[model samples]
Target: MIVKKRRRPLPLTVLSTTFVLLWVLMAAFPFIWTVWGSFKVEQDFFSRDSWWFAIEGPRTIAQTGSAFTGDGYYGAWVLRDFFSSVVNTIIVTVSVVVISLTFGTLGGYALARSGYRYTFWLLMLALVFRAMPHITLVSGYLLPFFEMNIWGHLPTAIIVLVAINQPFTLWMLHSFFLSIPKDLDESAMVDGCSRFQAFRMVVIPVMWPGVITTGLFSFLLAYNDFAVTAMLLSQPNQTMVPKIASFLGTIQQEGNVMFAVAAVVSATAPLFVLVMFFQRQIVSGLTAGAVKG
Candidate 1:
């Protein structure tokens, strides 16, 4: 029969798998290279064995003319300044997240539940501020803090970070709040709850995912900020992101163990924790919003 000549179909599954793998590599190449490079010695950073040239971390420093060695990630982690900066980053991120969520949730609930007409304009203004280039905002405010001796402490940075983060946070939370049925509010009031009580008991519980998402967004945004933190904070209180950048600049001429250690510890670790902690909530909140609309 003609079936005797049946041909095998092209291995589309293999092709699709290959394409997905390639895309993931393309998306993750920088992070992967950075992680590998974290294990490299500073002296080896520019060597032939360096990932900059070889697509993975350095294996040996040329200075020794001998075998490769370990970079001193252990020592870098013990560096008092590294630890201090890490503390500062954590404090900043946590503060921003909590404050942003507290304020954003309240503001969002008000706008969505109160039927305010001005919310659209307020939202537009928020988009404008968020859309403004980070460099420009940092530069514009730098002199006021650096030159004028205004609120030039860590508090200033916190304030600026929170203000910059709030608009989008409020908008995102507002969308989430709007997705909740108004019938819930009515039912709560019918059950002897006031507006504030209803929000506290009914709305807030259901909106926790959105609140968590906004908090993580704010935390990550504050934690990873470079220009703003650099401009606002200094010395022992400098945020980890800017400090890491400083380390990269100084290590350009040396063995990169310290830089690698700092890069991995400062930049990658918190982000990993953040993703792991709130990953499910983030997905659920985002998906719920999408489906609701």
Candidate 2:
């Protein structure tokens, strides 16, 4: 085979590449700075004297005999009981995602497949509910929860998160189901599978990308929620977001800001990992779901 010299890249391509690189740097700079500062003493990181203190970490070296230290992580994770918050966050978010997905899948599939006029109205109702301010809903729930003495618990937060997230899941999954041909469900039934079996065995497999996409959104809703979690859960039951806020509340205390910074990095890392891992599925699901009206 004869080899030919490659053509020169277009100027537009070069300009676009430069813009993208600059955008990435700008987006990443805060997290990068925070991560670097998380290891240094508060004074060094938040130096009024010079920005160079953050880079050199003179105080960090003097205090810990090293340029870097894990003191903030240790303090947050151990002394501040941030690990408990992590556990609570896991419990709340996992429960929210699971419950939301379970109901969302079943309900979404039903709504998508139904021929009845009520389905449209039901979705509209759900949209209305979703559109309402979350705080108002939480306020309404407070009276019931307080009466039932179920306030300030992990399950309370989980319940509210699920309620808040369910409408979104239903809408998204319903769109996904609509994008899929109805023939798949019918074909599975024709193959001697019951409707439920068709859904569980065949339809769900094909819908896996959408499910993952919806589940991740539900996970993030619960994971990043502050207003609901803070109001519903007590101090001991608090999750990472509220816990981090509580750390900031103690900003008057020495080194507490670092604790908050460490907690932020800890909480945010999982979301970055999740998005990176499921980015392809998210894009594919969105594209597929877009095929429908």
Which prediction has the highest lDDT against the true structure? 2
**Model 1 regions more than 4 Å off:** 1-11, 43-45, 49-70, 146-148, 256-261, 283-293
Worst 10 residues of 2 by lDDT: 284-293
* Residue range 259-282, candidate 1, lDDT tens digits: 556455556865777678878876
Candidate that would win on TM-score: 2
Question: Root-mean-square deviation of each candidate, in angstroms?
Answer: 5.5, 3.2
On the 0 to 100 scale, the lDDT of residue 194 in model 1 is 93
Q: Which residue pairs in candidate 1 collide? A: 41-256, 42-255, 42-256, 42-257, 43-255, 51-56
